[model samples]
Target chain A: MATRQYSFYPGCSSQKGASSSNYLTSVQAMCEELDIQLNDIPDWNCCAASIGYAGGGELPRLTLSARNIALSEEHNPGQEIVATCAACWLSTREAAERLHEDQSLLAEANQALAEAGLKLKNETPIKHMVEALIEDIGYDALGAKVKKPLEGIKIAGYVGCQTNRPFGIDGESYENPRYLDKLVETMGADSVPDYEKKVQCCGGALAFSEPEKSQEMVKGIIEAAYDHGADMIVTPCPVCQMNVEVYQDQINQTYGTKFKMPVVYYSTLMAVAYGRSAKDAALNGQVIPAKKLEAIAAK
Target chain B: MGDLNQAMIEKYRTNFLKEVEANVEEGEWVKMCMQCGVCSGSCPLGKFWDHPPQELFMMIRAGKRDEVLSSDSMWMCTSCYNCVVRCPRELPITHIMHGLAHYAKRLGLVPESQPTAAFAQMFWDNLMQKGRVNELKLGLKLYFMNGFGDGIKVALKHQKIGMGMLKTGRMSPMEAFGGHAVKDLKGFQSMIKKAQELEDQRIAEHGA
Candidate 1:
């Protein structure tokens, strides 16, 4: 297979020693197996994240992402910019879309960018890494590369919000996105295709600000996964992975329920299925360890 | 802040909806809502909210300016985009929610003790410092946001997780000194400053 290259934008969460640093690790491992080269956009800044609108307003928020897009255009020209973080992808893509649609906003954004020795061309295609995986590398090819099929494992594909709604993966329904399920099935796992809360919200950044409300939402997601008789849960978004995995202890205490389900990323699952070691798959990063997946990696 | 708030009230008079449409991002779409309750129903945190998205839009049209801006309902939005995709009228409900929240903050009407609003400010300050967020400082700041006593309790509660992350190299204590920064820090800060000035100017011109 020929090598595919993309300018990678690992957002704040995926930065070294940040919340989703493990995600970056597993993603790097997965890309190595898939023969994809991710060139880092030199000295990239935050995409203003989802909660940024409250402080950044519209134009500044747009400019923050526009700066990154401008830097990518200048440095990694002609390559599609891909983000591993869902919020990063959403904010950047939304900025590009809004800038393209509104020429006046584009001009204002460029005025800000000009101060930073940058310009908002709004020319590059912004994509989530999962979109690149599904569209660029089809399911058949992905499945063909699986060295060790994940047989006998019942996995529930949790297609949480951000990745599913607004601009979802190509040809996917907002409510019932089956791409995650298909990815699970391709890895030879028993996918719970009808996981009820697949598109449910894990409360995103509110997990820090309003723990009670966000935890309630997280409880629903994990409870639904357990109800489906699945051994583990998988998601593409960093916030989903962190919220669901790290909050189990608190949820168990708050709800008086014994919930210890391992919320792994789809990349982690793919890395393990592709015969990568547990370390390579970043299994140790899980707050609630996926013992079953770790055992699979050991095998 | 109070002067600007009062001026806006006097300008818009009894038309809160028009005020929002003129100033808020994607606020123009609020009129197309058609009173559909799908957005309210689709919200994961709808039950916890004092007024859901539908009710908020209704209140806006009713010209209940003080109640709408100080309600604290918009801050509850998680930006899940559930309401956006599910809205029958295709209202960009999520953006409107954030827009309302941002407008409220700008007018100095954010409800007292609003944690999300506080955290957003902290996150923004942290980001603008180095053009990137220092996770360690942000986490520490969040823990201590309420008070020293509350900060201690919350820090103690999450100590295990923090230690685990540190051990696994997912977080660094050294970041407290000075975390990663964009190479062109001068240019970045200047750009952000210029954008803020432009935005303020635009809002002032619109009000005038």
Candidate 2:
């Protein structure tokens, strides 16, 4: 295990908005506890996200994502880059996939990069931190690390479009799937089935594109989740977590629905379930009320 | 020389309900229709319609094409897929329903009470011209063609949304034509034509 480690890219949101950024501090603490070293790439930039390219063509999006990939390469060659933010994960994956698929495009992108004093060969594999954990570390072994084991609490997992779309990662299907729920169960909880609006986007770009539309979509998702009896929504992506949580107050007000859906990282949840203290995992920044979670945990 | 029972409606009895293409996942979707009537019960337009969802599936399988296509239920769907998710079997009911709607439109079997077919044609028109969907333009075009009241107000509201979208870089005017772009468009058209041909062949066989 000590023989391999990748440079981690936190992306823009991790540096600013998301609770998962603070969660990173706890993750670092946990990594220390687990004796794993994850080096952060220096002078890293944004992945430009899925929203940036929703209207724009491949050039701008690919260029933006490739710059970060280039930075990772400069810091640590011949090693993979692990991304915490879902948008970053998608962008990086897109860059890598696009660069690999079209040689001419790759040459052009590199030529554009040369102007910026950067080079991207498209060789590195960008893995979502969860993928690295579940695929690389294996579930049963991680299960051995669980000290608290969140037993009997009901949790529903939400993996937004970015984490699963554009289709390269091959472990699960985006629709009607059970992997995230299974991941939650691995942490020792019942994964509730809420099929309503499961595939609907939380309107990530719509927050910028059409704020009202964004609000409507957010309200719809929360209502659907609540109707299905999800005590809390656990997501692997930070944007999904942020949109679902930050907009909850707005959504509740707009739609007249009581939505107390706590958005949490699957890793943080696992860390807590395994008996790590809240400080040990940093669950404080979570948008969902911490006390409610404590009550669920205590039971 | 089989004796026909006067009480049994042969047309109704011919419907397997279970065998309908809509009932694709018989074990899952078929088993889950609790008949609690939440589907028919909760439907917003259920009271005004003659064939409820349960009956629609039955009609499709029974070859009661007239009843299924002529109903207002398909028009009122909104393509929300709410019923699909709520259904115990997860039958992709909305997808199946939309296919039936499209088939009805192509055959001119659609009722005048619903104009969903007109909407479909407008969507194609936008796609063919622009290579993408422009909801604002499409909506206005639709409203005008159908003589919908309050076109200006409706158009203005959507235009505001469209303007907002444009500002956010979520919606934009078509980009300047790039090298090899026309080739890509031609390839896409060919793919679409192949898909339509396949669909038409299937409908022909099924209708036969």
Candidate 3:
């Protein structure tokens, strides 16, 4: 098979935190096995997240997103821009759609980019790395690479709000959604029943904007997962992982509850299926201990 | 003055909850509150409120309109929706808080205990005017409007963060008057007009 290449944009959380670090290595190894070259974009900037630039006009936000896309279009040919972070996935995907839908805004944003010695034509398509692996590469192919099947493990999949809500590609829903869960099942694990808050926000920046209020939102999601008896949470978004993990202590203290649900990146979980070391996936750095997971792997 | 049936009010409770969800994310979960004490017990702020989760729901269920409207607990809810998360039935207690808060404000109840409401108004104002929120200006306005000098002190402590935003061309307070965000100023004006009209109607219908 010809080696397919992709330009991956690891958003801020991936750079600043350990979750993405663990995920990227495992994803890279999987890409290698699948004959895909997952390369990072040079000098990439933050996606400003989906909500961060809500105060700025569309142009500034669009311009910021387009600048990153422009680099991918200019430097790489044919490959889509693969965003590992949900915020980046949504922002970059919106950049492509919005640039086409609102021409006048696109013109203004391009002019701003021009001053910075860059141009954006929205030539490259923005795709989530998961989309590439599952949709483009095919799950059967991914399944073939799994050396150690995740049998008897029940996994709950969380697709943060941005990837599937407010605005996203068609055929996505909060009710009985099974794409990520199927991916988990394909790796030989049982996908747990869907819970109410699976697609909810992990409080994201709102947690910082209103700390006390944000803690409630976080606690609420954790409580829902607890209700479902989920052993771990597998998500593709780093901000969700960051928010859900960082606030575990606060949520535990406030709710008088003991929720030890581990949050694993989908890529990290897939890496485990690939028979790669948990350490290679940086599993130990998780806020919710995956000791059971580690023990299972040990056997 | 006529007596409203309890079932009739409960039937429309879903609609009221939906309205709160529209302003929030994961709003559907609000209607699922099972009256489980998990939310009350789990709530960090429950002990402080006179009308805790159970009481608030009971009042709503019984159509104890006067009691729910009169209480200060409604305004104190931070819209955290923690109750919804832990509620065995998933009642959107957070949305309830927001709806009741709005209703209280509309009824001319505790008109001053509405910092978050003012924050919402200012948020929409900025959005209507500039097509975005300018946190620097909004923060200052919110601080003064809330009459909390301590918030100003806290904000000032984060001056370096604000300066970095300015340096990055992200914190242009001057844009509040005229900038890319307010390019089509007319659209913003119309939005503000619509908001004011809505507020006026609310006050007329629900104001004391």
Best by lDDT: 1
Give the CAPRI class of candidate 2.
Answer: incorrect
**Residues B6-110, model 1: lDDT tens digits:** 889888997899999999999999899888799888899898889999999999999989899998889988989989988988999899999999999998999
| Candidate 3 per-residue C-alpha lDDT over B167-208 given as tens digits, one digit per residue, 9 for 90 to 100 | 423345664564333243453344334333443433233312
What's the ranking of the predictions by DockQ, best on top?
1, 3, 2
Q: Compared with the true structure, what per-residue lDDT tens digits does model 1 show for residues A139-239?
A: 99999899889888899999889987799999999989999999999999999989998998898999999998899989999999899899999999999
DockQ, per model, reads 0.79, 0.02, 0.04
Q: Any residue pairs clashing in model 1, and if so which?
A: none
Residue range A184-239, candidate 3, lDDT tens digits: 88888877657667766565544444556667767777777777777777887766
TM-scores for all predictions = 0.98, 0.57, 0.60
How much does candidate 1 score in TM-score? 0.98
Range of the 10 consecutive residues with the lowest summed lDDT in candidate 3 chain B: B1-10
Candidate order by TM-score, highest to lowest? 1, 3, 2
lDDT (C-alpha) at residue A291 in model 1: 87
Q: Estimate the lDDT of model 3.
A: 0.60
The model with the greater TM-score, 2 or 3, is 3
Better of 2 and 3 by DockQ: 3
After superposing candidate 1 on the true structure, give the runs of residues whose Cα lies further than 4 Å from its correct spot: none
